[model samples]
Target: MIVARPVWAGSLSFGLVSLPVGLYTATDSHTIHFHQLQRGTSDRIRNRRVNERTGDEVELDDIVKGYDTGDEYVLVEPKELDEIAPGRSRSLEIAGFVDLSEVDLIFLDKIYYLGPRGAEYGKVYSLLEQALEKSGKAGIATFVMRQHEYLVAVKAENGLPTCHTLHWADEIRDPKKEIGDLPGKAKASDKELKMAEQLIEALSMEWNPEEFHDTFQERVVALIEAKRAGKTVEKAEPAAKATGAVDLMEALRASVERARSPKVTGGKAAGPGVIAEKKPGAKKRIRSTPPTDGNGG
Candidate 1:
């Protein structure tokens, strides 16, 4: 196993109990960005700050944050407003404990591994780790990082304390409000449902993260490389358009067939798709029918 270097030294607490620990990021992201260029001349793009209403170029020092209160009125901020919230950051404090299964995976925004910071705090940190491991539970905690207190989950992972960001209840928007309404209130036919279930079972496979790759990003990079080498860019086949359908039975049947097919499922055996409706025990099956608009044929 590779050892991780600590990024921040701190202590975790819950009323009286405290453990000296260090934090290290659990993952890293690599995203590609493009530089803008002029449409015809191929000159690099440049941005300037200008007053929207007056069409005047504004200097950096002259720029001030503002909010529109409506009716063409604006509220400008003063320089002192930048230091609105200021205080010495405190270490992670675990206020409570919870079952590991209770929290949803979507709530986790970031992950960090906590290591024992010093020899003196080793005993206390070890004790906490052991207790959490023994109970097979995680601690519900809050930590102040970058001046903002974040809700997090703390648990013992591979003999080390691990922290993951938590999503508050308010942060989760209600799907009903966004979805408005759904079609096909009726359930699927026995044959359709059975076929779907069989297709799912036939395509089952173990989770191996290494097998996955971001093909979209890879294609973009490959295109750039081809352009640099003065080679022709490959054109991939256009994706099939989706068609919406009112026939619940037909949709389920099509999906079941697709799921069972090796080519459609990505391989001889592939994991289920992420659509919640397609999951077993789900009340409704969201099928990829053609679009309601003429975009799909």
Candidate 2:
């Protein structure tokens, strides 16, 4: 069994009880990455922090965060941030416990596994986990990690405690303000609504994450193999056309039939761009890259 190294170590305090614990990341990415290279050469492209005026590479130690205010930039030292929330950096103090159901799903962000620092603190950890599990509640806390303060909810999952970082309330954008063409107060016909419900029910299945794999990544690997062997890769089929309002009912009915089909449920049919099987030792050559968001952060 492989034991993961902790990213952060601190004491979790709730009321009078405090337990030494460590936080480990609960998720990983398996995206294939390629280095930026010159068009005609194998030379790699790299990023650097350099002075705009001098075009000289700057040492990381000499870099300080600056906030632009139109008139001037306000520089702040890294140590100043830690000094402002010194206790938060090493303490996970629960403010209160709240019903897990009451928390909105949109607020939840990254998840991390929390474990006891040593055998001596296992009992305390277990007690908190069991209590939270039995009560169906989560302990809300705030702590600083890597210079950023995060709101988190510690809850029990599969006999262990898991910490989920939460987005601040203000961070959630109002859909009403952001979406210009939202169909507000629009009502569907009873027949159409009933058909959609049936389609949903037909498509519903148990949440087994193991059943799904990254088909797109597999195609990427297949493309690389095909190119290496001097073979041409087939293009994927075009996506189904969007249904107009006039054809909505017909589309829903067709979707329901498709959902109930045996091929979609049990049979393995190689559709466009589907790779049947990966070659042995092929995965070893693939490099894992960090997952990026819309802004490429």
The sequence of per-residue lDDT tens digits that candidate 2 reaches over residues 22-120 is 999999999999887544344567999999999999999999999999999999999998899888899999999999998999999999999999999
Clashes of each: 7, 0
Candidate 2 yields a Cα-based lDDT of 0.83
| Candidate 1 Cα outliers beyond 4 Å, as residue runs | 1-9, 46-88, 241-297
lDDT of every model, 2 decimals = 0.68, 0.83
For candidate 1, the per-residue lDDT at 27 reads 82
- Please, what are the lDDT tens digits per residue for candidate 1 over residues 172-288? 888777787755365766786787687678668899989997776776676455444434443454556664546655766776677667663331211112211143543433322
What TM-score does prediction 1 earn? 0.68
Which numbered prediction scores highest in lDDT against the true structure? 2
Off by over 4 Å in 2: 264-297
